[model samples]
Target: MSERPYVLLSCAASIDGYIDDNTDERLLLSNDEDFDRVDEVRASCDAIMVGANTIRRDNPRLLVRAQQRREDRVNRGLPETPIKVTFTSRGDLDPQAQFFAAGDIEKIVFCASSAVDKCRDRLSGVATVVDAGNPVDLTAVLAELAARGSDD
Candidate 1:
């Protein structure tokens, strides 16, 4: 069996353990320094995964903002940015979201088995949706990522 990928769980939450409130605008959880640090971390990763809700709510580009960091990644024989990954249970994702629109690298969506077809039809050219078992098996996801050489 292929080894599971080394998962790095990164998030910015409040002291109250809230990542955001019910506001339409995203909460500012990090400062310039923190963002720079996060960018460095991102540059070192082979892929970055976030929940489907984060994509819908935040609409983040998920790109390495520093040109030097992106260039460094290229110099190391990597893509300009890491592969973008997202998980979904309902497959209710917007194809036009920045997650799909911004990056030239591969985009993967792990969906509940029940929603795989819907997600595939909806995402089509934008992303490759995999059936992540009924409850969406994270271990399997990591294994698949590892098999794809995204274990870092």
Candidate 2:
């Protein structure tokens, strides 16, 4: 197989090619049918990732909504929910966000070396914080995820 985990980027955009309208309220880009499709995709993956901006903006739980899907993962010897990941430069994240509080699965945070101490202090009980060099290296993050058995 490959040295790194297979990465899949999933998102929805409007017909006008806009992701959001810069509103305080969250936008609904996908309908119920498409949301079910996304749930299926989440069930198949070992992990799911978003940036700090996404967490700050959307505050998503990133959990498997279908009970059966969560059960299927447990039957397959995996966590009920996929591992959640996020990367940040300044490490400005709320400890009480849904991303940290809503799931029983592992949460990994990649941050710049300079921000490691502060990030760890803030997210100490909430996530596993890793320093990814001065600028937060994506390559290192991927390798670390692969090592943790995240094949997706």
Candidate 3:
């Protein structure tokens, strides 16, 4: 088995290589068929992660949407929803966002070392804040997640 969680970065981009059309309204980049596929993937993973910008922009719940999928996870001794993770440089995440408020699963925030204290203070009741070095170390973040038993 691998020491770190298997990471999959999924996204939809426009033909022009942009994720959005630069509008205030959220764009629908993926179709319903793709959404179902994404739900399946979410159900299979031990945790789901996004950046701070994604949390602020999309405000996703990141939960397993299908009841059967959630049940399967529970039957397999996993939470109904996977753990949620986010990385930030400024720790400017909103505690009221669905990323924090929508699920009973664990929420982890990897922030820059300089912002750790501030993030912990602000997100005390919402998420567990971890320092990710001066600029938010991706390696350390993955290692920590591995330590927490997130294998995928």
Candidate 4:
């Protein structure tokens, strides 16, 4: 079998191990320097993934933000940003969310088998909705992503 893509899990949390607090607004867990570092990491990746809840709550653009970095990627024959990916059991994602709306690159949604049609219907123009098994098998999802050439 072909090798699966390398998975790099990146996150920021408070000293108490909380990524966020109970608030309507999203918490700022990282400073500007930290954000710049993450942007560099994102630039090096083949795809960037977030949970559906993050899309709902944080509404992040999930793009490599620096203009020069974007140009560099394009000059390398890559997209301005990497593919955007998300997984959900409920498939309750907003097509208008920045995850879907911001990038010119591909957007992929891996949903529970039961939610596939719903996600496909809801995210038709926004993302490529995939059935990642009934409970959303993460291993299979990663294999599929590797097959699609997201090796980083």
Candidate 5:
């Protein structure tokens, strides 16, 4: 079999298994070193994924922040970073969220088949939304990206 194209879930977390601890409380637990390491991992990954909770809670820019790596992508003619992704089983992604306004960064959202009308209407090309059966399927998300020239 061929080596499967990998999609990475790279997230920062606190000791309590959250992308951030005291999530609603908005306490910071990560340092610059941790963020740099995350940038390094993102430089190598084909695509990155996050959950609805993570997106809504963070309102993150979601771009790799390493200047050196951004230059490398320019040298190689690759994208500034890998695809940024979000998952919402209902397809009810937040269009007004900061993530949607990140220019030059490609985003993909995965929704349950039944949620197509519910979510897609609000989002135009802000992100590509796919119906991956009910309850949402991560595997289908990866496959869709791969087919669209996003795989390694």
Candidate 6:
């Protein structure tokens, strides 16, 4: 594994600084080239991250489906799927959402202690929610993931 920061920051936004529109709708303004680029980045990194709102609205699978990304992951030995991560302070995640279902590998949902009770159940299939204790520290969450042998 390469020595890299535990947190890998990334986001998909419109050309107008909005992840979505004004109606709780999901908007993906990223072009095919941009999507390919994101796939490549995800292929190289250890984890792909987003906020809770991003996950709830978009329900992203966060996996690279393009041929190039798969080939790149093959070259890097990074696994066919990137670690899907979410930062939710209250653990207010819906486990039945497509975001959880679409993963080829396990999904990690990071929440605070207050959210653990909420996270402990309802999340099934190939995903698990992790309680990071009080205050929902993503820094600590990333550190823990890093310690678990993630490359970046």
Over 104-139, each residue of candidate 3 has an lDDT whose tens digit, in order, gives: 999999999998898998899999999899988798
Give model 4's TM-score versus the native structure: 0.95
List model 1 lDDT by residue over 24-128, tens digit each.
998999999999999999999999998999899889999999999999999999999999999999999999999999979999999999999989999999998
Q: Which residues of candidate 6, in runs, are more than 4 Å off?
A: 1-8, 12-20
The numbered model that scores best in TM-score is: 2
TM-score of each: 0.94, 0.96, 0.95, 0.95, 0.83, 0.81
lDDT by residue (tens digit), candidate 5, 101-151 = 874877777878888877888888687777777877767666777776666
The order of the candidates by TM-score, greatest first, is: 2, 4, 3, 1, 5, 6
The local lDDT score (0 to 100) that residue 106 gets in candidate 2 is: 90
Q: Which model, 1 or 6, shows the larger TM-score?
A: 1
Candidate 2 — which residues are off by over 4 angstroms?
A: none
Residue pairs in steric clash, candidate 2? Answer: none
Model 4 C-alpha lDDT versus the unseen true structure:
0.93
Task: Assess candidate 5 and give its lDDT.
Answer: 0.73
- Give a tens-digit lDDT track for model 2, residues 105-140: 899999999999999999989999999888888998
lDDT assessment of candidate 3: 0.92
RMSD values, in order shown: 1.5, 1.1, 1.2, 1.3, 2.6, 2.6
List of clashing residue pairs for candidate 5: none
- Cα error, residue 110 of model 6, in Å, equals 1.2
Residue 123 of model 3 has an lDDT of 94
